[model samples]
Target chain A: MGEKIKVDRVTKTFVVRDSDQKGARKEFTAISNMEFSVKEGEFLTIVGPSGCGKSTLLDLLGGLSTPTKGRILLDGQEIKGPGLDRGTVFQQYALFPWKTARGNIEFGLEAKGIPKREWRAQSDHYLELVGLKSFADRYPHELSGGMKQRVAIARSLAFNPDVLLMDEPFAALDAQTRETLQSELLRIWEKTKKTIIFITHGIDEAVYLGQRVVILSANPGRIKKIVEIPLKHRLADADIRSNPEFVKARHQVWSLLHEDEYAGLYI
Target chain B: MVAISKQVKSAKRLHKLTINPLLALQKLVKQSIVLLLFFVVWEIAPRIGLVDPAFFPAFSEVASAWWNMLLSNELFSHFSASITRSIAGFGLAIAIAIPLGLVIGWYPIARDLLNPILELFRNTAALALLPVFILLLGIGETSKIAIVFFACTWPILLNTIAAVRNVDPLLIKSARSMNISSFSLFYKVILPASIPTMFTGIRMAGTGAILVLIAAEMVGAKEGLGYFITYSQYNFMIPEMYAGILTISILGLIINYGLLALEKRLSRWKQDPTV
Candidate 1:
């Protein structure tokens, strides 16, 4: 498979006002010289301690923010700004409160320049894909946290982006809901066949979802190690998370994160 | 059987919600029993001389005075005149304030240039500047409308700025990733997000429009509820004065509910109303 995305020596830094010294500025590197590549149709899950720039990396991939020192490429083309080629599902769901579940889905199609007539069918198709066909007319506030996130996923997928960028999409949900969504997301990803980049703080989630887990350490985040999860079965099976291989992969990612010892403080 | 009946009861409630809002109003009317009792006390108090009839006329007397003015077409003329001025001033304030507020809120340059001036004028009460409006615009329809216009501007402007500024950042980020245009971003996301807060300002400005217009009219005017009430008070037509005051109270309520209804319509997706 060809490289779907390449994070080539990318480093993101911010010039924040120095707290101790008045009027002085200091450079804080969120991520330093991060280099990685994702193959076509690969499920890449990134895990890190807090402030390890996992989110900053996602923002760079989504083209919402620019890397301070290096460039990110999608299909070998430099990403200048956010476009329909990539779909993003945020942790907050970020569903338009004024739009219905279907309306939110239709908004993506509209942004993709799909005609008004095809919107209903296309949106309904994606809504069904996320098992939210019944909630087509329901508004964001009327939905549970899980349902809202499902609608967010439906809206993102409805746009038919080649790559799915999810930034801890299930982090806000309850334990049961989060587990359920994780399974559903995997199902959706398999069916859609999109290159997926999932960012999470959970060790089990990273190990379970990713074909390869990119473990990042904090304080100028650099990749500690990338653990490959060789699961016996791949799909939405809750039992798979408890499998021996799954447990082993999860353990590997956990220790990699804890390598710096500061991971315990954050945890 | 008990479970079946409970489901039926909920089904009936659902039917009322979808089909007949009048059935819903039954709940509201039942809650208004205290208001009904207040009217009853008001009717009997003056009749028994618990309150002076010359000053605080019986509820029946006020009703009769309201009826007579209605019969003479005097009520309609004054009502129309007051409504026209209120609508004109209120409409003009919204037309001006909402757009300006969006610009001021969305753009730092506009906010920086106009914020100090806004803070200065916003502090000076519209009622305090009634004389200035009357002095400059003269004691005419222009002054009455101008005073209302002045009073209505601040709330709508401030609220709109707040609405524009406070849109959820994550929502914007999510939309931008969809490759939405800047124009579509404002229309599709920011404007709708701001509607709830802007309506709050509009509702406040609605109250301000009536309050300041009445005051402005009371100072010098010929045909408003304020004028009618003051005129009747001076002529010792105590029932008529009370009737005019009653009309103002009703008008205030109607305007408030009207705005509420509007907010509900615009923000149909808003389950919990902040207002």
Candidate 2:
């Protein structure tokens, strides 16, 4: 596969004002020197502790925010702003509370400027893909955490973007649901063949999900290391967490993350 | 999507209302006990001379006075007059404040520019400005409606601003990532999300609409419930005044619950209907 996305020395900085300090300006760097590219149809997982600018990186890739330093290129075109070419699954689900499961999926299709008459069919197809066909009419408030995340995934995929950027999408789910969703995500990714960049703080999640695990460090976040994982675990035919190769890979990610005390993996 | 939701709606309706009618009615009566008790006390207290009937009439006396006005059709004119003014002022305020609030809430520059003026006007009570409105617009229907409009604006405006501001940032971020157009974002995400909170402001403004209009009418008005009450009071028709007060109370209750039902309908997704 050819390069699908290129983050060429991307850096994000936010200007924040202190409430107590009148007219005082301060600069906070969320992420810096994020130089990486994703190949087409690659399942890349990024692992880092909280506040490591993983979310910032995802925001930049999604075109919700622009990089302070360098530009991001998608299929060799500069990404100036948000576009329908990229779909994102936020950590918070971010499903509109007012919309039903089907309505939420239609949000993407509508943004993509797809015909109104086809929204229902496309939305239902994605809902079934995430195995929530029966809950099509249900709202986010009525859904469980895992169910809501599934709907979020369906929402992003329904838009049919070139790449899907996820920011700790399953971090809030319980152990069993998280594992089940990981397997399901792999299956869906295989079927769709969409390039995915999944961000997480879990060692096992990174090892199990990604073709390559990109480790990041906090406090002026920068790429720490990128570890290539075993192929079988990445393909995920079945529960592979107990596999020796998976454990070894997980340990390597764990050790790499813990080298810096502040960047220790919480999971 | 529409068909699926409709099916769910019917299924839910069927699953609900399984409660026996008798039990539901019994529960309703149980909840009404305190209100019934208060009315009972008012009736007995005046009749027993706990409070002199000359000053505070008995409930039966008030009821008879109310019935007399109802039969003579005197109450209908006043009720209609008061309602028309309240609705006009309230509707105008909603039509203006909601759009203005949405704009100010969403845009930082707009919010900053208008905030000082809003605070200044907000603290100046609507009733306190009645003299100014009368002086400027005169003591006619225009002034009365204007006062209600002024009184109602703050609650609806402030609440709407807060509602727009308090919309979950995550929702907007996600929507923006999908390249949702600015116009679509307003109605699709911001407007619906703001409904529940905005309704709170609107309900408060509903109460303000009545209270402010009545006070304005009492100042100088010919045909309204407020004028009726003050007229009856001046003539020492205590029972008639009480009747007018009762009618106002009922009107307020109806307005409140009506808005509440409308709010519940628009924001149906907010509630867990199954529960």
Winning candidate number (DockQ): 1
Residues B1-275 of candidate 1: C-alpha lDDT, one tens digit per residue? 23324433543453364547887698688899889999999999999999998899999989999999989999888888888899899999999999999989889899999989999999999999998998999998999988888899999999999999999998888889988888999989999999999999999999998998888888899889888888988999899999898888888999999999988899888876442
Worst 10 residues of 2 chain A by lDDT: A230-239
Residue A70: error of model 2 in Å?
2.7
Error of 1 at B6 (Å): 21
**Each model's DockQ score:** 0.52, 0.48
Give the DockQ-based CAPRI class for model 2. Answer: acceptable
Q: Pick the candidate with the highest lDDT.
A: 2
Give candidate 2's iRMS in Å, 1 decimal: 5.9
Cand. 1 TM to true fold: 0.94
Candidate 1 residue runs with Cα over 4 Å from true position: A236-238, B1-26, B273-275
Candidate 1 CAPRI level? medium
